[model samples]
Target: MADEENRKAVLARVHGKVQGVWYRGWTVDTASRLGLAGWVRNRGDGTVEALFAGPADAVDRMLEACRRGPSAAVSYTQLTL
Candidate 1:
């Protein structure tokens, strides 16, 4: 498939009080809901890193969701495609 047609990968580094705040779980849930394939993990630096591979639009939406994560989270960054 053409590069543009192929699924894109989104690498995100979320900051603020993200760790231990259900950020990863929220990411997993949101990605799953959007039919995305990837994983979210807690970083040693108190950040949350996630990789989302799927349609560009879905990935973008997921990133936007990351910007305003769950009630316990305070998103500070979202590096996208």
Candidate 2:
């Protein structure tokens, strides 16, 4: 699995206005559309935690989109990529 070996993985924590918003849904949709694989969930520290695995470029794009989260995210979202 050369592709798997070359795949990139990241555990990202998103902060600010992420909880109670459609961030998870948006993330699932976006990640799936980007052909990435990952799992996202709400953390006790009021942050969104996610593990993304895919091409490096796609992962970077996902991280960028996370920074500019869904419109539902009231406050500014800061994605810790």
Task: Give the count of colliding residue pairs in each prediction.
Answer: 0, 0
Q: In model 1, how large is the Cα lDDT of residue 44? A: 94
What is the C-alpha lDDT profile of model 2 across 36-60, one tens digit per residue? 9989999898899888889988988
In model 1, what lDDT does residue 30 have? 93
The lDDT of each candidate is 0.88, 0.85
lDDT of 1 by residue, 9-76 (tens): 98999999998788888889999999999988898999899999998889889988999999999887
Model 1, global lDDT: 0.88
The regions of model 2 sitting more than 4 angstroms off are 1-6, 74-81
